[model samples]
Target: MTTSTTGGRTTVADTQNPPGATGGRGRSARKRRAILDAAREVFLRGGYLGTNMDEIAALSEVSKQTVYKHFGSKEALFVEIVTSMTSGAGDTVHDQLPQPARGDDLAQYLREYAYRQLTVVLTPDLMRLRRLVIGEVPRFPELARVLHEGGPARAMRSMAALFERLADEGRLTVDDPRTAASHFNWLVMAEPVNRAMLLGDEAIPSPQELRRHAADGVRVFLAAYGPGAGHAPR
Candidate 1:
C-alpha cells in the first residue's frame, strides 16, 4: 500500500513561457518540480509546523528566494500538499469502487470492496498524511473538514450509493444506506487501521490479514442486511 499511484506532485509550470523559452521557463519548471518534491519529503518528515522554507530550498537545491518565488509562503505549499494528497485518495478510491447499480453474491462484492478500501487507507504515505492532518487540526481546523470531504466522506458516499442500489434490488435490507456503508467500511478497517495509526505501519495488517478482515466484515454485513435476515436498524 504505497502512495506511489496517486498525485504526489503538481507543477504550476508557466504556460506563457514555452518549454523552450529563453527566460528559463524550462528551468523554472524544473525548479518548481524540485521544490514541490522536496517540500513533500520535508513536510512528511517534519510536519507542517516543524517544516521551514529554508530547509525545503536547501533540499531542493534552489535558493530560498527561488522557493519563495515559486510558492510564495510555507503555508501555501503545505496546503497544496495536503489538498492534493487527500483529493488523490478520494479520486483513487472512487475509481477502484465504482458505485455499481447492483450486484450479486453479497459477501464477495463486499469482501472485494472492503479489501480495496483497506489497501488504500493502510498505505504508509496515507497513514502519515492522516497523522499530519490530525496534528494540524488544532490550529487549522478547516483542514480536518477538507480531509474528511476528500477522503472518508467521498468513500462512504460511494459505498452508500452502492448499498441503496442493493436495497432497491432486494439484495439487502438497508434502511439507511449511508449508515450501513459506514458500518461495513469500519468493520473491515477499525482494528487494523487503529493499530496502524497508533502503533505505526508495522502494526498494519498484512494482505492476507486484510483479506480475512474483509471476509469477516462481509459476513457481519450480510447477517445484518442480507435479504431474509430481518436485521433492522437498532
Candidate 2:
C-alpha cells in the first residue's frame, strides 16, 4: 500500500497488483512490508532530505527497481512511513482506552486511559518522526498536517466519544464533549510530550513518573468536568 496526502486528506493506494504484474500477491506483500520497514528505519535515522531510495532498497534487500515499483518515489515512501506509524499508534491508543462503566472509578479509568495514550505516543521512533516532520514542514507541510490529524486529532475524537458517554451516565458534567476532550488531552499530553520533544528521549518520564502525571491530569480534569462540577459550555 502507498499513501498520498491532498488538502490535508490522506488516500491509500492498493499497489499490490498492477498491470502485467509478475510476482505473486504474497511475494509482493512481503516486499512491500520489507520496504516499509527499511524505509522507516532509514527515514528515522536520517530526515527526509537525507534519505535516498538506493539506501532503502539496499537495506530491504530489494532491487532499486523493486523499491520504485512498490513506492514510486522517496517522498511517497516517506509519507507512507509517517502515515503508517501515526495511524498505528493512534489505533493502539484508541483500542486500549478503557470504557467507562457504571460504578467504575472514573479517576482510575481516566488515568489508565491517559497513561496508555502517553506511553504509546512517547516512543522514540514516534518522537523522532514528529521532530523530523516539523523540520520538513516548509517542504512537506501536508505531512505535518497528516501526522497531526492521524495521531492527535484521531485521539481527541476517541476521547470526545468517551467523555460523551460519561456525561450521559451523569459521571461527568460536560457541556461540550469535544471541548472537554481537548482539555483532557492537552492536560495529559502537553507537558510530557513537549519535554520529550525539546529535551530528547532521555528526558522522557519514567513509568512511575508518567503514572503520577496521568493521575494528576485526571484529577484536574475531574475537578472541572466531574459530576456536580457545574462545567458550563463555553
Candidate 3:
C-alpha cells in the first residue's frame, strides 16, 4: 500500500551508447528494444483499438516493415507489451506470499503482498492500461478480459491461494478465498489507487499516504477474519 513498494515509475531507461562502433547485429537488437519501448508508450496512450503500428514505428524511428517483422500485428504487439508489463510483477507478487507455515505470521505476509501489489498496480503505464481497459471495455470486452486475466485476476489468484493457505494453517477463517482476496484488494487500493487512476495520475499520493491506506486495510481485514475469528481450521 505504501509508495515504498509501489512501482510508480515505468520509464524505460536509455541504454548506454555502445563504445565506439557498435556492431550491426547489436544495433539491430538495440533498435528492437527501442521499438518495444515505443510500442508500450503508444499502447498506453492509444489502447488496443486506437493504436496503429505506423505511429509506433515512427516513434521507434523504424520503418513500418521493421515493426511488422518484429511483431506481425497490433494485437500481437499489444499482447507482448501486456505480457511484459504484467507478468514480471506477477512473479514478484507470488514471491511475496510465501507458503504459510505453522506459527507463520499472517498479517506480516498480507502486508508484504499488499505493499508489492500496490506498487505494481500504481505503476504509471499499468495505471494507464487500467484506464484504457475501462474506457474500451464497452467496445472491446475481450481486451479488458485479457488484461484482467494477465494482470489483476492473476494477482487475485495468488492472494487467494495465500489466504486459503492461511486458513489451512489456522491463521484465518476463509471458506472462499477468491471472494476474500477480492475484498482485501478493494480495501488496499480503495483510496489512493482509484484517485490516482481517476485523476489521471495528476496527483501522486505520498509514500506516507499510501502506507497509511495499506495499514488501515490490513488492520480492518485482520479484525474481520484473522487469528481470533470463530470458525477454526478443521
Candidate 4:
C-alpha cells in the first residue's frame, strides 16, 4: 500500500501488484490517463509554479503518491503534459490531411487545407497552451522547443510532403517544397494566430473569416507556385 496526502485528506493506493500483471498494467494506465487529464486542467488554470500536486491528485481521484509514482516530480509532469498535448494535436492535424488526387482543383484543395489547419490550430485551448508555453520559456526552454517541433514544425513537414507530391504531378512548380510550405503556412496562419495570441480568445476568427483568409492565401500561393508560374525567382 502507498499513502499520501491530498487536500489535507489521506489517500491510499494498492501498490502490491506484481510485476507483469495485466490488471496492474491496466490500472496503471488508467491512473496515468487521469493524472494527465487532471494535470492539464490544473496547469492551464494555474500556470506552473502556482499548480500543486495535491490539487492534481485530488482532482484526478488518485493518491498524491500515485501522481509522483507516475510522473516523478512536478517539472517532469509539466514536460509530459506539454509534450503529450502538442503531439496529440499535431497528430490530429497530420492524420486529417486531405489526400490530393490528380486532376483535383489546386485552389480548392489549398483553401480547404488552409482552413482545416486554421480550424485545428486556432482553438481557445491550443492558443492558451501556446501562450502558456511561451510565458514559461525562460524557466523551461524545452517547453517552447517541444511546442514548436510538435506544432508548426510538424505542420510544415506535412505540408511540404503534400506539396512535393503535387509538384511531381505538375500541379505546382516548386524549387523547394519546404520553403513553399512555409510560405503557404504563414500566409494562412500568421495574421490569425498572432491576433489570437496577442489579443486573447475573443480575437479568434469565425469559420467564414477563416475561409476568406484561406482563399486569399491560396490565391497568393498559386500565383507563385501554381503550374506555369515556373518557380518565380526563388
Candidate 5:
C-alpha cells in the first residue's frame, strides 16, 4: 500500500472496508475502492488525455507502481471509474424498485425512483463525471459503451422486468416493456439532464423541478399503459 503521492503511503487503512478481517481480502477490496475513488476524481478533473497513473497514485496516496499494479493502465482505470459510477447511478435505482410491481403503489414508487435518479445526476461530482464522459466519448468509444452498459441499458433491462411483471398482472399492457421503459426514461430525463450537461454544474434543476418531472412521468406512464388503458388484455 505504500506508494508515492502527497508525501504519504496509501495504507490498507485508507480503504472503505474496515481494518483487519478474515484473510487480506477485505483489505484488498478497500484498497480497490480507494483507488477507484481517487481515479474518479482525477478523471473528472483531467479528462482521459489529461489523466496519468502517477498523478492518480499521488492523489490516491498510493505509490506510482502500486497504481500500475492495481489498474494496469490509465484507460483501464478510466473504464473502472465509469463502470462504478454508472452502476451506482442508473442501475441502482431500478434495483430498488419493487420486484412484483405493486400496481397500487406504482405512483409513489416511481416518484421515489425519479428522485433518486435526479439526486444522482445533480450531485456535483457526478455531474462533472457525466460531462467528462461526454467530452471523452468521441475519442474513446469504449467510454460510451461502458456508460451505456452501466447507465441507460442497465436501467432499461431492469425496468423491462418490472414492466413485464406489471403486464402479467394486467396493470400494464406493454408489448415491448423494454422500449416503453426507455421511452419513459427519456421523458423523465431529457430536459433536465440536457440543460445540466450543457450548462455544466450551474444548470442543475431545483428539487421542485425534479418533483414535477417525476409526477409527470408517472402520470404519463400510467395513462399510456396502466390498468384502464384498453390495451390491457381483457
Candidate 6:
C-alpha cells in the first residue's frame, strides 16, 4: 500500500489484496449462511427428527465435514433456526408488532399492528416451524415449552410493554397489561394460527380475512381497554 499527500489531503494509492489471501472469512460466512438456509429448508420439509445432516450438507452444496464444522450438530442448527425466528433471521419479525404508543390513532394502530402480526405469524416459515415443534414436542415435551417461552412469549412481553405504555398515556385503561396483551393476541391469532398449524401450509387466512380479524380484535380490545370503560385502573 502507498499514500500520497495532495493539497493537504491524503490519497490512497496502490492498495491491493495480499497474495495467498483467499478471503477465508467471507467464504466461511457464506458457507454458514448456506448451511442455515439449507437447514431451514430441510427442517421445514422433514421436521427435526426426520432431517439429517447429510441432506443439509448436500442441499447446501457443502461437504459433510464442513457442515459439522459450522453447525456442530443437527440439534444445534435446529435451535439456531428456531431462536432466529424471534430474534430476526429476517426483516419480518420486528416490524410485525407495534412499538410503544407513538401518537397514532388507537384503533388504526391496533388494526395495523394486528394485521402485520397475523401476516407474519401466518407465514409458511413460521407455520412449518410450528408443525415441526408439534411433531417433535410429543417425544420431547420440553421443546414445546422452549418454543413457547422463547418465541411467542417474547412477543407477548413486547406487546405487554406497549400496552403498559398505552395505559400510561391514557390511551387505554388496563389493570393488567399482560392479560390485556394476551387477550389481544389470542383475539387476532387463535383461529388462523391454529388452523394453519393443524391443517397445512395452505391453510393461511386471506388478506381480507386478516383485515376483518384485526378490525374485530381492535373493536373488542378498545371496548374493554378504551378510556372510561371504567374498570378502575389498578
Candidate 4 regions with alpha-carbon error over 4 angstroms: 1-20, 232-234
Q: Which consecutive 10 residues in model 5 have the weakest lDDT in total?
A: 9-18
RMSD of each: 7.8, 7.1, 10.2, 9.0, 8.5, 5.3
Q: Which prediction has the highest lDDT against the true structure?
A: 2
| CA lDDT scores, all candidates in order | 0.83, 0.90, 0.77, 0.90, 0.77, 0.81
lDDT of 3: 0.77
Q: Candidate 2 residues 39-108, lDDT tens each?
A: 9999999898889989999999999999999889888899999999998999888875657779888888
Error of model 1, residue 137, in angstroms: 1.5
- lDDT, candidate 5, 137-217, per-residue tens: 777788778777877677778778878887877777788888888977787777888888788777888888889888898
Tens digit of per-residue lDDT, candidate 1, span 1-234: 122333766444455445666567668989998998899899988898889999999999999999999888898888878888888777776785645445456677678888888888899988998899899898778878988888778878988988888887888899898999898877877888899999998888889999998899899888988887786643
Residue 122 in candidate 3 has what lDDT? 82
TM-score of every model versus the real structure = 0.82, 0.88, 0.77, 0.87, 0.81, 0.85
TM-score of 4: 0.87
- In model 6, where do residues sit more than 4 Å from their true spots? 1-22, 89-102, 138-142
* Per-residue lDDT of candidate 3, residues 112-150 (tens digit): 667777877787877887787688677667777777786
Candidate 2 vs 6: which has more lDDT: 2
Q: In candidate 3, how many Å is residue 228 off? A: 2.6
Instruction: Decide which is better by lDDT, 1 or 2.
Output: 2
lDDT of 4 by residue, 1-234 (tens): 788898999865645545557686789999999999999999988999889999999999999999999999999999999999898888777886658788677788788888888998998888888989999999999899999999889889988998888888888898899999999889999999999999999999999999999999999999999888966543
Output the lDDT of residue 15, model 1. 59
**If ranked by TM-score, best first, what sequence of candidates would result?**
2, 4, 6, 1, 5, 3
